[model samples]
Target chain A: MKKFMNDPETFIEDSLKGFALAHADICDVTLNPSVVTRKSLRREKVGLVSGGGSGHEPMHSGFVGKGMLDAACPGQIFTSPTPDQMMEAARLVDTGAGVLFIVKNYSGDRMNFEMAAEMSENKVAMVVVDDDVAVEDSTHTTGRRGVAGTVIVEKLVGSLAESGANLEACVAFAERITGSIASMGVAFSSCTVPAAGRPTFQLADDEMEFGVGIHGEPGRRREKIAPTDEIVAMLLDSICEELKPSSGSEVLLLVNGLGSTPLSELYLVMNSASKWLNRREVAVARSLVGDYTTALEMAGISLTLCKLDEEMKIHWDAPVHTAALRW
Target chain B: MKKFMNDPETFIEDSLKGFALAHADICDVTLNPSVVTRKSLRREKVGLVSGGGSGHEPMHSGFVGKGMLDAACPGQIFTSPTPDQMMEAARLVDTGAGVLFIVKNYSGDRMNFEMAAEMSENKVAMVVVDDDVAVEDSTHTTGRRGVAGTVIVEKLVGSLAESGANLEACVAFAERITGSIASMGVAFSSCTVPAAGRPTFQLADDEMEFGVGIHGEPGRRREKIAPTDEIVAMLLDSICEELKPSSGSEVLLLVNGLGSTPLSELYLVMNSASKWLNRREVAVARSLVGDYTTALEMAGISLTLCKLDEEMKIHWDAPVHTAALRW
Candidate 1:
């Protein structure tokens, strides 16, 4: 697979060791339950938990720390963590306040997290994020699949939870924020699954996939690779087609890499996206561009736009400290 | 090239625009001089400036913020910036405490920064970083290439400068820190240069290059693709072979990707490197793992180790806010 891993079977677990060790002071990892919780939980704060399959680093697990997630329950590659894992995380991180689970919109993730919420002793609120405007449904998902906007939801809601917001308040904020965002991705090549030991899909030397899913699912359409300006305009047009922010409306822009796309390409895409927005008269108030959400070293970029209001802007700018996404 | 860009000739400038706009809250970007400096400079703090080719995002520019570099001058892809860029940066950033130029160990970078220092009005200390233990000399470089160790030098020296270290003091610490660091890299594939419109090098599907340079320069040797454990072992052994830390010495480990290498692979490399260190009884006091320094779309990881002492540890842990790194 051309990946730096000893064995495909052990990659996820061994990667967790690196994740835990990298942020040893901030997180305490439990292997059997497969949960990573904050080292010191707040005594009276609503606990925050987010999890998904592996491969998307700096998303769920890399984000467990102060002013962000209280715990992250990681599943295997692109697979949902079990109900037991989420229950264990809730039990470990819950204080006198309740617990909130940030689940993405995929069917497996929603099913597992819902059961985990009902099984937990503490009061729990589950907020499902479904912000990808790529499609209304996908091959691996029932509804619109949650994409890069999950990172925004976690940052905004985690900031509120850290500030002593109740479970309902965090859930409301998560829903509002999730509703305010949209994402669309462009892929230059398909990714390789470590276990599968082959490329997930094939592309010619001059082809690109538009609206590709994060898990290497087939995108909405394929076409000959175009110039950067054209590629960016198409992605932004798809996102804005759903979100439909009017002229002069303030927004937060997130240009994320699918995986193998380097920062140069990411920034170039951001540049074109910015030009795209500027021509439309939209005011970009805040921007977060990087490879926060990925598809296992796939060559692509996803453009996520978060329509921000005054209150949302405050929460978005709040301080956060994690293994990744620190500010 | 499969990169996202409107045009190869305009990619660097447009990408810089993305960079400036991304961190608009923190930086002031000038087009003619191609300088990116802090919006607000601290008077009496020694100014730190580092710059090189534009493709190395977050290295010279993503690092221009509080507690890191005061200004950065980005050249075209894989080319050294001119002296005028550095001179303009020094002119704007210097607040009467002079400036420190952190130049990588490339002939073009050294020559250009030296010329800029001679021409600038402000007192300057130029510290050259040559910690790549790959080979004594090779194409595109003389002596060892600076590689990823420049990030360490900037972080340490930049922190010291922010604390108001004088020019001489910054230079002394820079030399000491530079002497105590070593780096080595491994590449699975060569990157494509947009300007060149072709791949920099070629490799068989089953071959891997060890002791590679950042700019896709040839490595010391190429070997058959091996298991991840053996790959990490080779990289760590090369780095340790040069630095030769005592058994109990502590270090700050930096596992950097040469762009396109996903975080999944970066952490896997870190996982194996950490295991390698434990077997040798070395202490990892601090770890920074991500794509800090990168060649554009080069699929590889570079390991940098800075043997830390009491003072260096304190400075390393000190808070610094930048586009790529914030705490």
Candidate 2:
């Protein structure tokens, strides 16, 4: 495969090593069970931890720092992390206020994080995010798959936790974010796992996958490639349909690039979504555009709309210091 | 060409519209002769302006904000922006303290920026960046081509300008940065300009273009893909040879992605480079990694090294708030 890595077996380890070294001021990497923890833990504050498969980077790991995730456990590419990884991460970042696990809605992730929370000696709470509105079930998930909206949930809840919220309050805010956000993705091409050494799926030059998952899982349907406006409308339609915000409601719109999509394209998608929302009299209160969550070298874009309240807006604007995100 | 664009002719405009919308808090986009200028100009500070072909995104435009560029002019994809665009940007951002034009060493860009400076009424100084050590002359340039190092020049010089340096001092610091930094890129696959509807060039499955330019210009040679360590060594060797940094010298290292390469891969490259630099006893005082400057969707990585002084280190740590970068 045409990837910048040494061995498929050691891909995650190698990347984690680099990640820790690059952001040495923010976080540290612990090998054996594989966990990324904040360099400095805030005393008596809720510890926020998140994790999942490896390929969708800057997601769990890059989010580990002040005002975001306190620890992250990464699994093999497109594979869920073991329960031990999560427990170890909890052990590292658990202040007296306890640890709150932000688990995405995937069967493996849900099961493993639950086990980790149960096994932890420290007070622990879990908030499962199932924000993707693409489908009811998918290859790795039993219900709606958590997608780009996970980033939004992480940011808002992390901010709340950093503000010295208790574990119970952090979990409530995390759940509130999960309920308010909706995401859907479209792929022009599929990404390959390094070990697999080939694309997970294929699309004709003129075909596109709608509502695709982060792991190249099947979406709602496959259709001919459409213009930017039409594709954006389709994704946003799905999101707005699920969330059903009133005409005067406000939202934080996120245009996320899946690995290989250009920032220009992601912004174009954002423009289209904003225009679409404006027509319905929905206000875009805040916006984020770039590659926050990705599926390896997949060429795709995901649109997330989070119905925002004053609390969400305030915390979203709060300071954050992380590798992939900061303000 | 599986790109998420409406029409090739309107790609840049659409993207810019979205960019202006998403970052309305930081910058404004002017359409006719496109220019992205800071939302609030810091009056009397030397205005830092940079521009180039559109594809290397988050470069000229995304860098326009506080503690960075005051303005950026974006041309059509892979083509130099017009003199009018540059002149308009200078007109918009110049606040009595004169404008400093940071031009990459591309023939077309140099000519257009020079013409813009000459025609404009505002006092202007230019620093042409030719940081690439790949070749003495290349397709788009007479001297070495400026690649990722332009970001370094803009960051350092931009910081100096933001710190209220005089136009002359800013120009001197820009020149110092232009001379101290060196960069080289390698491409695993070619990128397609939307209008072209085809890849810039083709490569066999196992081959890679070493010392490639940001525009997919021919590099030193095509060779079979090598291990990550070997590739990192070759790139760092060329940079060190040209820069000839002493063993104890401290430098800022930037591992930049060429649009489509994954962040994991970029961080892996950083890990390898850090190891290589440590072996030589050269200190990596500061590190920046990710897709800062990118060719639309080229799958490659570029390494940039800037020998650092205490002054540069202090300014490098200065706060910058831009779409693609912040601290």
Candidate 3:
């Protein structure tokens, strides 16, 4: 595995060290429990917190800042963070308004965040996001696995929280987003975990994995590589089937790169997705194209579609300041 | 080649179409002679224009928005844009105030921008950036080749232009930035061009290309892969040799991913770079870590350091609202 790392055990810590320094203006890193919290705390505002495996960068950690996540707990690689980490993050970010935990639908993540919420002293609520329509069950998840659409949940729900929503309101909006969004991914190549020191899976040069999970989990099937439009159609078809937006409905389309995919290719995917939606008479009111949630160095792309209402659109357009995401 | 592209001939146009759509709020795309221009032009402000090949994304095109390049022309992958594209872009952005062209130090790019400036009707000035300290001369350049440092030049100079600096002042500030920054890169694997249908260069599984260029140009040497610290040391040594920064000097450190490298690994590199700079008593006043300029889907990282002065820091801290960069 050709990776720029020293020790696999220290990979997350080292990367976090750099991350803290690089974005010191916006967030601070607490080492023991590995919690990243916003530099300034807003009093009486719902504290939005989310986290998962470390491989999906710019997710929970990079999303910590004004108008986004209040804090984030990072686990090791594809492993879930301990309950203590989540508890610490909640404590750091929670003001008088209480805290909300945005947990992805992974067995490990769900369990850990649940434990944290149960033991927390502050009023805390949890919203499990299972936006991935690729599969009902996966290697690390029991139900549909949360994938790239978690970014949409974090951004929209975080915006609502930033607008002084209470903890219950934040939880309600997060659940609404989780139900409205769908995502599916395709992998051109598998990623190498630092500990594994080899690719998670192997594929011939002409093959591609469809509906793959974020951590290289098995997808629906494998087939010979197809044209860009066909590949995009496969992912979008699954997503659209789940969402099933009616004609004249507006939505936010996200073409997210699962590490190693170039921005140009992500844009290409976005272009094809826009065409597909237009043909179906679905208006794409908002679009995000780039690597927001990545799986190590995997070469793939994920398409996320969130059926948008006026409330969601207002929140989605709100200003956000974070490390990997800022506007 | 496993790329998300329909046809190699239309790769650039298709990607630009998606980019324009994705960032419609910030910029617009003009075809025929493709140019990405800011959505709202600033009348009487010196126009900043930059362009080159298409593969290095977010460089010339993604940088086109408020407080950055007023316009950018994107050519075919790894091919210089034609003079007409530059001329057209200059005409579109030059509102009363003269236009300033920021050209990277490449034979074709320099020649084309020069021709465009000579044939233009509006007042024009050009600043050629050659910040690469990898080698004095290379395959695509006459002197030192420009690399990731071009982003620094564009950001700092673009901020100056946005602050009502005239064409001559912008040119002077760009030159000052061009002279102060140094960059170098290394590639673990070569990227395939969509048109070529194969990798541009091959490396043994355990080997790496040191000092590689954005277009897969040969660097100083190739050797077996080294540890992250050693690699950071080597690249930093070359860059520091060129700059000879004093111990107490402050600099903006940028750890840029070529294309396919993960953000975690890039942060790991930044961690190592910070250590190296710290050992030398150099203060990192500003930091940027991620893919700013890329070479298609190449797996590599580059380090760029620009010595920062009080004025430069003020401009660098100014607001910028571009597709790839915003604050």
Candidate 4:
């Protein structure tokens, strides 16, 4: 493999070690190197926690800072963290205000986070997100899986928690925000796990994989590669159909790159998505375009649209200080 | 090639259209679409004008905000902007204070920017950056070509300009700071020019290129891919040997990813680079890790080290607002 790694089996541990060392100002590690906690915390505010597999950098770990995830427990690449990791992270962040876990909608994650909440002595709650309207079921997931909207959920709800919201209020906001969001992705090529040393899936040089999951799993369909506008139309059409926003309604838009896609391409996607929304008379309240939730070295882009209300808009505009998704 | 693009001939223009729409709050295109100027400007300060080829998003264009470049003139993909484009940008940003053109050391860019300075009426000075100690000459450049250190130049000098430095003062600091910087890069694959319809160069799956230029030009040598530490050793050693910072020196380190490289790998690069500097007893005053200067869709990383002084540190810590490289 041409990857910049020491060993396939030890990639996650080494990555986290380096991550903690590099971002010491904003984060620190606990007894378990896999669990990252914010360097500073508010005693009277609800504690926020989020995590998933290791390949998606800046997802859970990079988001652990002042205005985002309070603690993150990362697993191996494309694998869910164990309940023990979550339990330890829960204990680290549990002040008198209580703790909330932002869990994605995959079976392993769903089961393990549930186990952690049940097994922990602290009062724990989770808001499971399933905004990917791509497929109802997938290889590693049960119903519609969580995708890029997880970034939005963390950004919006994390800000609310920082505002000294109670645990119940944070949980309710997470659920409400996730319910109004829809995400879909397309991949030009698949990614390889460091241990596997080969791609998880393959696409011909001229073909594309539409509605791709974050783990390089099979999507809704594969099709011949098309122009930028047509490809954007297909993804936005699917999202717009599900969202059904009225002419005067406003929403927040996210155009995220899946690992290896260029920023230029992501900007193009935003440009196209904005034009489409304008033509449909749907006002876009705020827009974020960058690589937030990514598959390791996967070449693709994902789009997430969150139908917004006034509360979410104000929370979204609040100052967020994190390694990623900073304003 | 599997890229999200339409009409290769018009890709640059189309991409800029989208970029302007996406960042309308901070930037806009001048009458000449190739010139992107900050929406708000300080007329009394020296106007910083930077331009080069397109494809490297968030570099020239993304840096055009309150404390960075006053205007950025982007050429077609991997091609230098014409004298006319630079002249237009120079005219747009020029107030009572003169304009400073930060040019990378490519032949086309050097020639075109020189012509633009001569052909314009505004008081203009050009500072050429050749910090890439990779080779004395390359495909499109003369002397040591400019690489990621251009980002450092733009950031530090631009902030200085915002503090009301005159044209001569900005030019002197730009040259002094650029002189202390050194950079080197490695690429696993060559980037394709959209109009060319193929990668600029070829590499076997297990082989890698060291000292590769930002535009897919040949480097000092090609070798079989090795472990991350060994690869980093070669890059850092080469940079250290040329710049030669002493044991008690302070420096700002940058680990920049070529486009298409994952952030995880970039972080590892920073981790490795940091450790190497520590072993050498070199104190890193500041560090930045991400894709700042990129060959479109190339997989590799570059290492840049700038010997920092007290003035540079203070300017670096000053509040600067831009699309990329914000604190």
Using DockQ as the measure, the top candidate is 2
Q: What residue pairs are clashing in model 2?
A: none
Give the 10-residue window scoring lowest on summed lDDT in candidate 4 chain A: A9-18
Error of 2 at A113 (Å): 1.0
Q: Against the hidden reference, what TM-scores do the models get?
A: 0.98, 0.99, 0.99, 0.98
Off by over 4 Å in 4: A31-33
Give the CA lDDT, 0 to 100, for residue B286 in model 3.
97
Question: Between candidates 1 and 3, which one is better according to lDDT?
Answer: 3
Task: Tell me the tens digit of each residue's lDDT in model 4 across A172-254.
Answer: 99999988999999999999888889999989988889999999988889999998888888998999899898898898989
Query: Candidate 4, residues B141-203: lDDT per residue as tens digits?
Result: 879898899999998998899999999999999999998999999999888888888989999
DockQ of every candidate:
0.73, 0.83, 0.81, 0.67
lDDT of each candidate versus the true structure = 0.88, 0.91, 0.92, 0.87
> Model 3 in CAPRI terms: which quality?
high
lDDT of 1 by residue, A271-323 (tens): 88888999999988999889899888889989999999998888888888788
- Candidate 3 lDDT by residue in tens digits, B1-327: 799988888888889989988999999999999999999999999998999998998788899988889999998999999999999999999998899999899999999999999999989999999988988899999999988999999999989989998888888899899989999999999999898889999999999999999999999999889889999999999999999999999999999999989898898998999999999999999999999999999999999999999999999999999998899
**Model 3 score (lDDT):** 0.92
lDDT: worst 10-residue window of model 1 chain B: B260-269
* Tens digits of per-residue lDDT for model 2, A95-209: 7899988888999999999998899897889988888899998999898998889999899988998888888888788888888999999999999899999999999988999
- Report the candidate with higher DockQ, 1 versus 4: 1
Q: Weakest 10 consecutive residues, lDDT, candidate 3 chain B?
A: B163-172
DockQ of 2: 0.83
Q: Tell me each candidate's i-RMS in Å.
A: 1.2, 0.8, 0.8, 1.4
Collision count for each candidate, in order: 0, 0, 0, 0
Q: Candidate 1's residue-wise lDDT over B238-325, tens digit each?
A: 8888899889889999999888777877877778888889888898889999999998888888999999999898888888888888
Candidate 4 chain B weakest lDDT stretch, 10 residues: B25-34
